[model samples]
Target: MRTIAYFLVITLICCLAPSADLSAQLNEPAPIRLRNASFEDIPRNSRAPVGWYNCGFPAETPPDVHPDPMNQFQVGMGPQHGRTYLGMVVRDNDTWESVGQELSEPLVAGQCYDFWINLARSKVYLSQSRVSNKPANYVTPAKLRIHAGYDFCDRQELIGESDMVRNYNWQEYAIKLSPTEDYTHLVFEVFYETPTLIPYNGNLLLDNASTLIPSPCEEVVAVNSPLVNDDQKEPISTDPVPGPVVVTQPTTKSGDPQPDPEPQVQLGQSKQVLAVDAVFEVPDITFVANESELTPESSASLQEIVDFLTIYDNVIIEIGGHASQKATADFANRVSMRRAGSVVEYLRTRGIDPRRMFPKGYGKSKPVCYDESADCKRRNQRVDVKVLKIE
Candidate 1:
C-alpha cells in the first residue's frame, strides 16, 4: 500500500509540471504580421511596392523593388528574406527617395517593442546609361533612416538610423521603440548626416522589415526568415545601451504657398557678416526641371538666407544660376539667368537692398559632374551663393 501511494504522488507531480508549462506558453504574445513584409509580392519593375506609397514627389524617382536584371544590378547579396527587396536613391539634386506604409495597427503608447530590418548598399547602381560619350555613374554610399509618425508620409519622430552601410553584404539592424504617442505610419528615408554637406548620389537596399512586436521575454527572436541562409545568425547585442533620440518638428506640406514666420531682425546694430572668403550654398533651394520658378519647399532654406542678410547689412552676395545639359546651350543660358534673377527678386521683397546683391547665370559652363547621368545633370543644374564683399 505504501509503495502504491508513493507511485501515485510522483505521477501527480509530473502531470502538474506539464500543465504549468503549457499555461506559460499560452501567455506568450503572438508575433505581429506586417503586410508585404518581405517585399515579395510586388512586380519586378514597379516603382512603388504593393503595400507602400512614395513619400517623395511624383516627378522624382520612386523607390524600386530589386533583382534588377535589366540594369544588371544583381551582383550584390540578394534579398535577406525573399526574392525581392526595396531600393532607394539619394540623388545629387537634393532629392531623396522614400517609401511609407500604414501599419496594420497603431502602435500603443508606452509599450516597449522590438523592430528590425535588413539593409544593404549596392556597389553598382546604374543611374543612367548614355549611348554616346560618357557612361553611367554608379551610386555612392549614404545613411538610411527609419521614422515613425501619426500621419501619412510624416517623419516627425526618428526611430533608428544605420551608420553608412557601405558594405555590399546584407546586414540586420535592430532598434527598440517606446512610443510616447500612438503611431500608425512608418517611413524609410535617405539623407545626408548634415544638410550643409554637398548632396551625393547613393543607393539603399531594404528587406525583411518586421513590425513592432511586443517583447515580454528577454530573448529576442532572430529576424532572419526562411529566405535567408539557414546557417547565418541574426546579429544581436546583449544588454545594448540605447542611443540619443532625435525628433524633428513637423514640416509644412509641400505646395502650400503660405510662408513660414520670419525671424525678428533688429536694425541699427553693428553689421556682422561672414568672412569674405566664406561661400555658402543653400542645400534645399531647388526648381522644377528647366524652369526658374522656386519650389514651395525652398521657403525654409530661403528664410535662413534672409535672416543672414538681415544681420550682415554691409555684405554683398552673388547668386549664380546654372543649368543641366537637358536643353540647348542658348536655352539653358536664358533659363539660368531667369533663375538667378528670381532669387534676387525674392531677396529684394524680403527687405534686402538691391545694391548689396548681384545675380549671374553661368549656364552649363561649369558642371559639377561631367558624366551624362541623371544625378550628374541634377548636380550641374543648381544655384550657388558666393559672398563677394563684406564691408
Candidate 2:
C-alpha cells in the first residue's frame, strides 16, 4: 500500500512541476517575425522595387513625370489638403494596392499577431485601407469595403489601424490580428484614401518593418510545423558578447548625410527578433612610429571612419594599439599607448565624443601576424578596432 502511495505521489509531483515552456497568452512573446525594410530610408534617386505598379497621370504630369533627382531625398507627393501631383506613385505588383511588402511566411489560424511598419507622409494624403480581388488596383471600384479581417494569404485578422498620419514624420503603424480559421491567401493594404480618386500623390517614407507573435512557444512550434519546414529563420549567433557599437559621423560640414549607426549584434547573439548584430570595422591605416599623427595619405581612411560615426552617434569602441618585437616590451607598451591616444585625440578634434571612444595599449603581447620579418612586424605593430558593447 505504501509503495502504491509513493508511486502516486511521484506521478503527481512530476505533473505539477513547471515545464520549460512559455505561458499560454494569446499575445505571448513568442512567434514574432521581422524583415529588413527599404521604405524607412528612401534612396535619394533610385527606382522602386519590381511589380510596384504606377497608375496615375501619364508622364506629362510636370514635376511628377520626372525621375527623382540625384541627392534629392524628400518625397515630392504634396499634402492631403488637395493633390498637387508631383511625386513617385508605386503600388505592389501582387495587388497593386499600395500595400507594403508581403509576408514572406504565411500566418496561422486562431492565433493573434501584430504587423508593424514605419510610415511618414505629407499632410496632403490620408492613408486608407481596403480589401479587393486578389490582384486589385489602387483605382477603387465603389463597392469595395476595407475593414480589419483575416487575410487568407497571410492568415491574420486586421484588428487595428493608424489614425496618426501626415506631416508628423516617420512613426509606427501596427495591425493586430487573430484569424478565425486557418487559410493561406490574403493581404492587408494601406492607401492614400479609402476610395482613392483623382491623381493625389504624396510622398511616403517607411522603414524598420516587422511582424510580432505574442508567444515564444507558439513561434517554436510554428517553426517546426511542416508548413514552415522549408522556411528557415535568419541564423542566430551563438556567442553572447556582441562585437561592439559602431557610430559614424561626417568628416566635413558640407551637409552630406551621416552613415547608419544602428548597433547590429554579431550573428546569433540576439534572443529577440529585433536584436541585430552591430557590424562595424575600422578602416585600416598606417601611423607614424611612437606617435599619434595622421598622414595626409591617411585622410581618406580617417574620413570614412568619421562618416560612419556621424550617422550613428550611439556606439562604443575599443581603439587599441600594439607594438612589434623590435622594441623592448616597456617601450613598445608606451608606443602602443601613445598610438591609441593619438587616434582618440584626432577623433575628438574631429568632433567625436571622447566618452564613446576608449584607448588601450597591448604592447608587443598582442601581435596581428607573429612573424620576425620586418614587414610582418610592421603589420602587427598597428592599431585595430574592437566593438565592445552597444545599447
Candidate 3:
C-alpha cells in the first residue's frame, strides 16, 4: 500500500508541472523592461555598466562607465541622469566601442513604438594607445548611432542617429519604430563622420534610455484621380467575365510637345533650376593665405555647390581658383591650380561626377576687387564656381 501511494504521488506531481509552467509564461511582461535603462546600476572596477554587455568583438574593450573620478577618461561634463552614464570611444585604429542588452520582451510586429534616449559628446576625449602604449591622442566630437535587432548581438537596424554631437550639454533624441518583425535588442555605438575612410578617437555619452511605448499608427489619405466624375454610373455588364482594368501612360501632343519640368533644388533655400541659363557666384569660398586646402568655412560653401550640381545633373560648371597679390605670378598660378583641384576633389568625394566639372586657375588675373586693401586681397583669394553648360 505504501509503494502504491508513492507511485500516485509521482503521477500527481507530473500532471501539475506543465500547468505551472504555462501560468508563469502567461504572467511574463509584454513590453520590454529596458533593463538598467538609466545606467545607474554600475559596479565598481568594471568597464561596463550592470545589465549591459559589449556588443563588439572579443578583442575590443567594452564601453566605460563614467563620471570617471580618477581622470582616466575625460567626459567634459556630468551625466544627464542619476550619478553616471555610459561612454563609448571610437579609436584611431578603426575600432569603436558599443554596448547592448537583450530586451525583457521581444517587440511585436505591426506595432509602432516611441523610443528615446539622452545623448551627449565630450568636446574632447583621451585614451591609452594600443600602438604607442602611452596616453593616446585626444579627438573632437563624433556622431552616435543607435540600432535595434531581433537577435541579441546582431543589431543591424538603425533606429536613431545624430550628426557630430559636438555639444557638451546632454540632448534628448527620439525615434519612432514601426517594426516589421519582432526585435529584441538595442545597441549604442560611436562612429566617425565618414566611418569607412576616417577613424578618429571620439566619445559619446548615453543615459536615461526611455522604455518603448506603443504609438498610434500614422493615418494615410487616399488620393482620387481628378479626372474621375462623381455622378458617373457604371453600365450593367452583359457578359459574365470582366476584363482587367488597363492604366494608360501619359503622352505628349504630337505637334506641341511639352518641355520637361524644371528640376527643383533646395539649397539652404529653395530654388528652381531651369534648362535655359543662370549664373551664381560662390562668394564664400575664401582660402587662407596661399593654402590650397579648404577650411571648415570653405567646406560649407563647397557643399552648397555640390547640392546645386547634384540636382541639376545636366549642368556643368568651371571651378575657378584665384590668389592674392602676395605670391609671384608663377607661384600664384600653381596655388590657384591646387585650390581648384581641391574643390574638384571635394565635389568628387561628395558623389558628383568628375566629367561634369572643369577646374581652372586664374592666377589673380581676374579679381572681384582690384584694390590693394586687406578686404580686396581677401576677396581676390577666392574660388568661383561659374555655370558653363546646362541641358
Candidate 4:
C-alpha cells in the first residue's frame, strides 16, 4: 500500500509536469520579490481594474476600464461576437507597458518553477510578430506564441498556450518554465494577429504577473490535503465548504499568556473593511426545536434574501447552512442537506440562476458555538451567506 501511494504521488507529479522541463526548475528556491511597473492612471472602468503595461515598446499607455481614454491610447469599446457583451480597445498610436520583478535576483537554473498571470479577460491572445509587422490594425492573429523568454524578438520560445475559445472572466494564467541555461534577464512580449493588415498598436490588460520558485509538492500536500496538484482541483476545499460567518478563535497575544493592549485610532481616520455587495447568507426559513428546519419565522428571512437577489441583477451568492449538536450524526447530516436543498429550491422560484448559486449543508460538523447548552446550540444551528465570486 505504501509503495502504491508513493507511486501514486510520483505518477501524479510526472503526469502533472508541463513540457519545457519547467517542473524541474520549480523545486529550487528563488528569492521572491515584486516590481510594480504600472502605466499612467486612466479613468476607472467597472470591467477591468488592473491597467495595461509595456513589454518592449518605448512608450505604452496604461489600462483603463472606462469606455474612453482621456489621452494617448485611443480607447474604444467593442463587442466580441460570442464573448463578453463588451470589450476595450486601444486607439491608434497608444501602447501600454508594465514590468515584473524576478522572483529572485537572478533566476536559478535546474529548479522547477511556475509562472501565471491573473487575467481579467480570457480567449485573448498574447502575440509576437516580426519587427516589420508594424500595422496597428493587424491586431489579432489566429495563433499566439507562449513562453517566458521573449523580451527581445530574438529569444522567443513558445512554452504553452491557453484555451482561447471560452470566456474566462478575470482569471489566472499560469505557465511553468525550466531553463536549459541561466540568463540574468528575460523580456516579455505580447501581441496578436487575425489575418488582416489592420493597425498594429498592441493592447492588453493584465495584473499580478509573477515568476516564483514553486514549493515542493509534498510540503504543500501536507499542509493542504487537496492542494491543486495533478488533479487540477479547486484550491479551496469543498467538503464542508466554509460558510459566511466563520468565527475563528483569536490568537494568543502575549509571551506571558497575558492579553495585549487594545488598539486605538482617531475617529474618521480608520478604515473599515468593505463587505462584498452580494448577500449570501442562508435564509432563516427553517430550523427545528432541536433540528434544522422551517419554524414559520424563516419565511421573512428567506424573502429578504430573495428580495436582495432581485435588487442586484448581477450578484451571485453561496449559502452554507449548519446544524447543531442536538442531533445524531446521521440525522444532522440529513437535516443539513435538506436545508441546503430547500434554500436552493426557494431561490429558484425567485428567478435566480441555479448555476450562479451554490448551496451546501454541513451538519454539526461546523458549529458556530461549541458549547452544548440550549442557547449555544441554537446559535450554532445557523445559516451563513458568502459571496463566492463577484461579477
| 1-391: candidate 3 lDDT, tens digit per residue | 9999999999999976666535543433233447667775331223666667778657877777777656666554677776668887877777788878887778776766666667666665677776566886455566677687966567767765655655456666555656666778878778787645756667777888776766545832121111223465221222112122222222233223234344444343325464344435576786666578787787777767865664355678888888887779999999999999989998988767899888999997887776779898887887766668876
Give the alpha-carbon lDDT of every model.
Answer: 0.66, 0.43, 0.66, 0.43
What digit string (tens of lDDT, one per residue) describes model 2 on residues 1-391?
9999999999999888754332222222234333223221112233332212222223321112112334143334422211111133333321222332243344555555645544444333222322222432222211111123234233244443443233233344444555554433333333444434443333443444454544222332111101112255211222122122222222223334344333333211112221223333343556775566656666665555554443334557677777788789999898888888888888787767788888898899976576679788867766655556554
Comparing candidate 2 with candidate 4, which one achieves the higher TM-score? 2
Estimate, for each residue in 32-149, the C-alpha lDDT of model 4 and write its tens digit: 3333221112234322222122233444332243233342233343322111121233333434232322322544455444455433232332223334454333233121224444
Number of the top TM-score candidate: 1
State TM-scores per candidate: 0.45, 0.41, 0.45, 0.31
323 in model 1: Cα distance from truth in Å? 61
Q: Model 1: residues >4 Å from true position, as ranges?
A: 1-31, 72-77, 128-138, 215-391
Q: Alpha-carbon error at 283 in model 2, in Å?
A: 6.9
**Backbone clashes in model 3, listed as residue pairs:** none
Candidate 3: global Cα-lDDT?
A: 0.66
- Model 3 Cα shift for residue 381 (angstroms): 84
lDDT of 2 at 25: 27
lDDT of 4: 0.43
